[model samples]
Target: MKSEETPFEGGPMDGRSLPVLVGPTGNPPKTYRIPVPDDAGGPPTVLVYRRVPRAHSKRLGLPKGWKYEFDPEGKRGGGPRWPWSKPDPAPDATPGGKPDDTHG
Candidate 1:
C-alpha cells in the first residue's frame, strides 16, 4: 500500500479516527486507544487509535515517566488502564556521595 493511503496523512491525528496500517502484514490487525493526559488537566482526554503492528504501538507517545499495559479485551472491556499514580521515587542515599544505583 502507498504511504498516503493511511489515514494519518490528512494531518495530526484527532485521536478519534481509526488509523489503518499502510503496508506490511502481521498478526490480525487490532485496534488500540491510548489516552493521553491533557496538559491543562481536565476530564477530556485525547484518545488516539492505532491499527498497526504491536511493535509500533509505542509510537502513541505516552508521557515521560508514565507507562501502560495492553488489554487483550480492550475494546470490549471499555479501554486500557492508564498510569494514574506517579512512579515511586528512587531511594535516597548519603547526601555527600552520588545516589546508589544498585538498589531501588
Candidate 2:
C-alpha cells in the first residue's frame, strides 16, 4: 500500500502509454506521455492522472474530463485552465449563458 509500490500484487503491472500536455494556469503547456495501464494493479492510483479543460485539451490534442460541456470547443484562442482555476465568463457568451466549469 506504499505510495511507491506498484498496486499489482501478483505480477508485473501491465500498462499502456499515451502522450499528453500538462500545465497549471498561467504556465505554458508541457507535453507528456501518460500510460493507461491495464487493470492489473490491485487498486488505481491517482499519481499520474490530472484533468484539463476542453479548450486546453483541444489546444493540446487531449480529451475532456468526466463532465460533458455543451461547447466542446473551448474559448477562442484560450487554452484549457487548471482544474482548480476559478471559472471565468466566456468572452462571447451572453450574460447568463456561461461555459461549463469543469476540468477535462
Candidate 3:
C-alpha cells in the first residue's frame, strides 16, 4: 500500500508530480494511465505514460530511481497472457521490408 511521488515528463502531465502506488516489488507499474475527461462530455481519453529511470548509479550504472515519460501513441494494453496459453501467431511478412527485420 506504499506510494512514491513520481514525476512525469512531457504531454499534459508535464511538470506535475503525483503519488503513484508501488507494487510489492517496490517499483511503479510499467505504464501509468490517466483518464482525462472530455470538455464536450464524451468518453474520457486515457493518457499513457511509461516508466523510465530518473538517474543511474555512477559505479554500476544501474537505475537509482524512476520517472514517467509520455507515450504519444498510447497503444492499448493487452490482457494477461499466461504461460500455459497459446502464443501469438507470426506475421506472414515484414511490412517494412528492412534487411535486419526478423519477420522478413
Candidate 4:
C-alpha cells in the first residue's frame, strides 16, 4: 500500500468532497457573498466594503493608499489615511519590528 494514497476515491457520485484552490483562478484572497436584495421583506440596509487601497482606480483614475470603504447609499468616505504618516509610524514597520516592542 502506498503511504501517499488514501483508501477513498473521489468522484462525482461518491459524495466525496474536494478542496478548491482559489488563487490564480481570478479569485481574490478574500471574498464575500451576499444574497440578492429584497425591498419589501428586507429592511433598509447599508453595506461597507473595505480593501487595501490600490494605486490606481479602474474607473476613476490614479488612487493612493491601501484602505478603502464602500457603502450602498452612493456616499463614500474620504480617501485612505496612510498608516505611515503618523509621527511615531506604526511600530510594526519600524526597526526591531516585533509587536510587543511597538509601544515605545
- How well is each residue in 1-104 modelled by candidate 4, as lDDT tens digits? 11111111222113322232234542222311224456798854443333333467778875442322333443443456687754445545846765565567
- Of 2 and 3, the candidate ahead on TM-score is 3
Structural similarity to truth (TM-score) of each candidate: 0.23, 0.16, 0.73, 0.17
Candidate 2 per-residue C-alpha lDDT over 4-103 given as tens digits, one digit per residue, 9 for 90 to 100: 1111111122242222222343322322112344488654432222223434364776544321122222223346788998777666886667667688
Candidate 1 lDDT over residue span 18-75, tens digit each? 4233336322134435566778888655443334322333678533221123343434
Give the residue spans of candidate 4 off by over 4 A: 1-41, 50-66, 72-104
Once model 2 is optimally superposed onto the true structure by TM-score, how far is the C-alpha of residue 79 displaced, in angstroms? Answer: 9.4
Worst 10 residues of 3 by lDDT: 92-101
Alpha carbon lDDT at 64, candidate 2: 41
CA lDDT, candidate 2, residue 89: 64
Question: Looking at candidate 3, what is the lDDT of residue 15?
Answer: 98
Clashing pairs in 3: none
- Computed on alpha carbons, the lDDT of every model, listed in order, comes to 0.40, 0.34, 0.90, 0.37
lDDT of 2 at 9: 14
lDDT of 1 at 50: 33
> How many clashes in each structure?
0, 7, 0, 3
